[model samples]
Target: MKVLYVLLCCVVLCLNVLASSDEEDDKQLVEMERSADLENRKRLHTTNTFIKKHVKQRTVRGKITHFVCQNAVTMEKLTFMFALPEQNFNEDPVIQHAMELELQREMHEGLDLTEVEVADLAYHEKNMNDLGSDRRVMLKPDLALLILDIILNPTNYEHFDFIHTCRMIGLFWSVKDPTSFITNAEVTPDDNTCVIHHGTTVVKSFQYDDDSIVYVDNVTHKVLNPSFVLDLA
Candidate 1:
């Protein structure tokens, strides 16, 4: 009984010492990594201001995007740019993406959105991104993000004096084409409304040659193009 007791005590002490040593080693590694990260962030700040202003970078693989508003008054339209560094540690190909974003500004009189309406809105937003899955273009949003509304007495349009459903979607787009898959797509206002499939995508230019084909180059299925022409009334 006495030998068994001593052996148990010895084992417990050994385990405690091993655990403490492992914990200290982990702490030291974490501290070193944090110091390195801080230095990298400082370097990034000094090196690029565009990313600092627009993107909230975290770790080497993640970024939090900010919306670039078109008009402060009517922020119905926006654009955004995401800079992805290649060689995260210096071996990957860095790519910068720019795209248009849309948000609706409606004037509903005493109308309350039902559960279905809210679900539909979420579905539409998700569908927008899903439609572009083939291009590996995904919008990674920030955790500490919010959508706030400001009541505006819009005088331009009659019959409405107060604003309720007003939320902004922000993005940025440029022409010096970053991605290889790109072409021009346009949605013109005809007698009827154009149901744009991917209006938020960055386009090269519109084709007057054939409205049926949105964007075409030397070959087929090689264009970052979409259609606003849907068979509707």
Candidate 2:
């Protein structure tokens, strides 16, 4: 009977020791987590404060064709006026594709037109998936303040040039060749804001009015810009 009691006491003592060890381990773990969270909070607060200081406040809208002096003296801004129809404003993809076709048509004045079925088949095959546009994306103002801020402020940017820029305006347009764009466009004061009467609705006009040419560190491929102000009203 005394031996049995001794054994029971030993087991209880062992369990108590184990429980205390487990509680200590849990307490350490909780402390470590609290320290990490506090550090993260500090970092996040600092980052938020830093970013708030440099954010730009002003905005300029509309598509821009530009004539900036090589020495960064006088920069000229010009935009064109287009009479876009109501249908073009509502169904955006149709309007976008139509613009590209218009560019091809303008560039290829003498080429024969393809049948609707053939063109549709080619388009569907090449573009299998369509990314639906959010109303916010369509509604985001083509504000030029971000470009202005980058030029004026230089934390992420070390170098910037006020280069001559022009736009052959259309809905879905890319620089034919950025290298060619660098030296190819001639900007006389007279035709800088040109009006090539490609007519409204049918011909679909393009405008280049603004002096906001976006450039990266060394690469010429641009991913984003505050270009093409969409006030198609």
TM-score leader: 1
lDDT of 1 by residue, 17-75 (tens): 99999999999999997765544333232223322222333321122212222223222
Tens-digit lDDT track for model 2 on 101-121? Answer: 442233223223354522332
The all-Cα superposition gives candidate 2 an RMSD in Å to the true structure of 23.0
Best by lDDT: 2
List clashing residue pairs in candidate 2.
Answer: 64-209, 64-210, 65-208, 65-209, 65-210, 78-209, 79-209
lDDT of the candidates, in the order given: 0.28, 0.29
Model 2 has an lDDT value of 0.29
TM-score of each: 0.30, 0.29
Clashes of each: 14, 7
